[model samples]
Target: MTRSEPDVRAEQEALFSTGAEHYARHRPGLPAVLFEALPAGYGRPLTAIEEARLVIDAALDAVSGIAYGVAHNDPELAERGRRTLARLRAERRAPLSPTGDAT
Candidate 1:
């Protein structure tokens, strides 16, 4: 049987609250070697579009961590991920570009 909207959302929220807590806690940092591989603009401030891209990347990572945590039978990871998303939303009030979009 098909689940109702609230049911699905509830399930999702539950999973988010539980899964990924461990993973988020011990998440590893990118190695310096990887940064050295990039062409340029490594240390400079990000441009508008670039900053937007960073935000998108962070969101994607947080979501993945949450999902992964859920799949692995962890829950707090999801809550951590949700907090990250909330923070990102709060910090991203300004437009990313002159057109007010990443594009």
Candidate 2:
């Protein structure tokens, strides 16, 4: 005997129904290192530092959920994120020397 499509959908729905709140509360967010990137750039509106932090936190948490899924090899969504991160590492730019040409 084979399960009907509705039966499969029902089972999947039940699995997440109980833990929705836990999922929302325990999620991770942006790394603190990213805050340096948010400084004012000429005419941009000044967002209150507190409000800006909340937004950044929410964004980080959301993306971390995505990255966690991707990192663990969830093929269903594994192809959906940044293609470069797995292969490429980031390099910080070196500061220019106080003296003349850095060359």
Candidate 3:
């Protein structure tokens, strides 16, 4: 079943709030200079993972928009969402170069 927009938004807001609260409660008090001293590779994998996650999130958001548009009888919004999904799918199928750009 498609979820209502408000329901989905509330869930996202709650999740973000929880994450913020956790960080606030447990994050270290280390100075910025200490973080800067760490090796470059220390956070490279994390950065890559986060970048991948953002791409996935964009796809999911398009899907959610399609669902919401359909539920609300907004054909224009639904079509736009469909186009976004199609473009994303094409990008996914394209051959990637060594540097990760589609070629």
Predicted candidate 1 versus true structure: per-residue lDDT over 27-99, tens digit per residue: 5463444333332323444455555555666677679878987898778667677777887788865655577
lDDT for each residue of candidate 3 in 1-103, tens digit (9 for 90 to 100): 1254532333333233333433444575634453333223233432333344444665676677689989999885576567667766776744445665546
- Whose TM-score is greatest here? 1
On TM-score, the stronger of 1 and 3 is 1
Residue pairs with backbone atoms closer than 3 Å in model 3 (clashes): none
Tens digit of per-residue lDDT, candidate 2, span 1-103: 1234532332222222212323443443644333333332113443334233333343444355458767887753333223222311242223334442232
Superposed by TM-score, candidate 2 places the C-alpha of residue 10 at a distance from the truth, in angstroms, of 37
Candidate 3 lDDT: 0.50
Query: Scored by Cα lDDT, where does model 2 land?
Result: 0.35
Sort by lDDT, best first. Answer: 1, 3, 2
Of candidate 3, the 10-residue stretch with the lowest lDDT total is 6-15
Which ten-residue region of model 2 has the weakest summed lDDT? 10-19
Q: Lowest-scoring 10 consecutive residues by lDDT in candidate 1?
A: 6-15
Q: How many backbone clashes are present in model 2?
A: 4
Give the TM-score of each candidate. Answer: 0.50, 0.26, 0.42
- TM-score leaderboard ranking: 1, 3, 2
